[model samples]
Target: MSSNQAFESAKQEYEQWGINIDEVFKTLKNIPISIHCWQGDDVGGFEVNRGELSGGIDVTGDYPGKARTPEELRADIEKALSLIPGKHRINLHAIYAETDGQVVERDKLEPKHFEKWVTWAKEHRLGLDFNPTLFSHEKAADGLTLAHPDPEIRQYWIDHCKASRKIGEYFGRELGTPCLTNIWIPDGYKDTPSDRLTPRRRLMEALDEIFAEEIDKNYLVDAVESKLFGIGSEAYVVGSHEFYLSYALKNDVNCLLDTGHYHPTEMVSNKISAMLLFFDQLALHVSRPVRWDSDHVVTFDDELKEIAMEIVRNDALDKVMIGLDFFDASINRVAAWTIGTRNMIKALLFALLLPHCQLKELQENGDFTRRLALLEEFKTYPFGVIWNQYCQEMNVPAKESWLQDVQKYEEQVLSKRS
Candidate 1:
């Protein structure tokens, strides 16, 4: 049967469950996932004085044809965006700044360094988000940045973050969308520390200094991300979830949750509801963690679906700022962005098509047996049919047709890169 006929049959089945497929389409279209720019280049941003990837995070594999320049990275992102349905935003790190071969220190970075990016974003009519790159620098060689013991070192990072917020403000003012400027530091001890309180206190003070200047909330929204542990930070991380949660609450800033930043057993999906209760807004770095905090590309697994369900069912779609976060140098970088982002959108679409109200009622009524049964049965629903319809409606290649485009692009563009 043709795709349209299949979609009609699937629509009828979901409609029986009181699912408004048309309304689902409308809601899904407005949801914009922020695609990270690092995926195209394995987090290797274009800095004249680029350093090795450190801060307890690592990107393995020696994939060739990785984006080597800002222009190349932008082109790769455009290619991925063309394949994924729906309008989306691009998330950038401060290291992606273009300085014309000049040595612009992180603390001294200005909005002019990102003018090319703003121009490109304007051309595509896409929104931009920013992050302060607190890793891969000499000052952070000891695995501490904001919480560093040295007064000068802490001050340097503080300045960098402050500069990053201004750059984020610039993007928002130029693009007409508020920019989410997130600060994620790799501040932790490799082994046990004598005094954890000192570092936490230092971090708090540094953050206060960074956010001392009051920028318009309409231009930039600030967020702080926490981690359970990382490669060198297995023993202690300064920005623990509890630390940032309390800090975010007290300071009136958004707290960012990275899926891979939690313990293997801890589910970020479960924390969404609890967080929404206290904070007016939340940010997310949706990444797949393999056993540990290995930044693997996201898959449409149980947790991803649950996360999407929480956002949709609680009506926190606008409250939660969604952004992709993973860098795999193992495969085709462009395809990596396309696959991870498409799965994120797919999970949202799946959540949108579900009868969330009915499920909640079943639970509220204490009908546990029916709730479990219906949840399992809906897993077999024609989710793919609806996804294909979305891709078609969005004017992108449906099904596996997008892979062919990536392969062709690799042959024509990427393969030629040194």
Candidate 2:
């Protein structure tokens, strides 16, 4: 049978279980996954054209055709978006701003620095998200920013974050979508800190100062990201999950969970339901981690599925903000973007197609045997058939045919870059 016929049969089968496949497709179509700009360029923003990786973030492999400028990055992003289904947003760091060959310090950034980005986003009808570049600078060489003991240094980062919020507000105003501005500082010690409390306190005070100016929530959504440890921050990370979670809850802001930022055994999926209970809104940096915080490209793995299930199960899709946070420089950058995003779309669809109500009924009534059996049996269902339908309806290539386009792009566009 043809793929469409197979999907039709799968639809009939799922309907017998009371699953509305059409509603799942409609729901998944409306959700936008924000793709990280760093993936296209290996996190090498074009500020000053340094091209050197820092901020405790490292990208392995010297893959050719890394985007070296804003224009190239956008071109690459456009190509990747072509292969992935669904409407999506673009996440940008302050460092990606087009300064026209001028050195614009992070703290001194303004909406004007990103005016070109706003224009580009408007052209593509893509919502923009913002992040303050908090590391890989002279000031952050010591693995501290907002939590630095020097008030002058801390104030600089505070000013930079405040400026980022304004820029985020500007993007939202121009594009008519709320821009999420996330703050993730790489402040920590390689060894045990003599005083952890002082740095945490300083960070708290700095955050308060940065958020002092009020902006309309409709325009800007502020978030703080936490990490268990970074390369140099193996011994202590000031912005632990507890610290940021408490800060966000108390300050009426959003807490961001980066899957790769936690311990190996601890999954961000488990935290979603618990976080939703306390906060009305939450943010996620979806990425795959090998053993530590290694930002590998996302795949349709169990962890990814569980994260999607938690969001769909709690009916918190609208309340949560989903964004990609992976960069793999070893392979074709555009292919990495397409694969990660398409897999994320598949995971969400898988979650949406599950018979959650029926499973919940079994679990609530202590029918553990059947609940487990159904969960395992549902895994073998014809999910790919529906996924192919989704890709076809969204006008994107499916069944690995998208990789052909990626190869063509590499030959035509990326090969000519260097």
C-alpha RMSD between model 1 and the true structure: 0.7
Give the distance in Å from residue 32's predicted Cα in candidate 1 to where it truly belongs: 0.7
Candidate 1 on 51-80: residue-level lDDT in tens?
999898799887789999999999999999
Across 1-418, the per-residue lDDT of candidate 2 in tens digits comes to 9887899999998998989988888899899999999998888787874545677898888788999889899999999999999899999998898888888888899999999888999899999999999977888888899999888988889899989999999999999999999999898999988998989999999999989999999999999999999999999999999999999999999999999999999989999999899999999999999998889999999999999999999999999999999989899999999999999989999999889999999999999999999999999999989999989999999899998998898999898988
Q: Which stretches of candidate 2 lie over 4 Å from their true place?
A: 49-51
**Candidate 1, clashing residue pairs?**
none
Candidate 1 stretches greater than 4 Å from native: none
TM-score of 2: 0.99
Worst 10 residues of 2 by lDDT: 46-55
- How many pairs collide in each candidate, listed in order? 0, 0
Instruction: Return the top candidate by lDDT.
Output: 1
Clashes of 2: 0
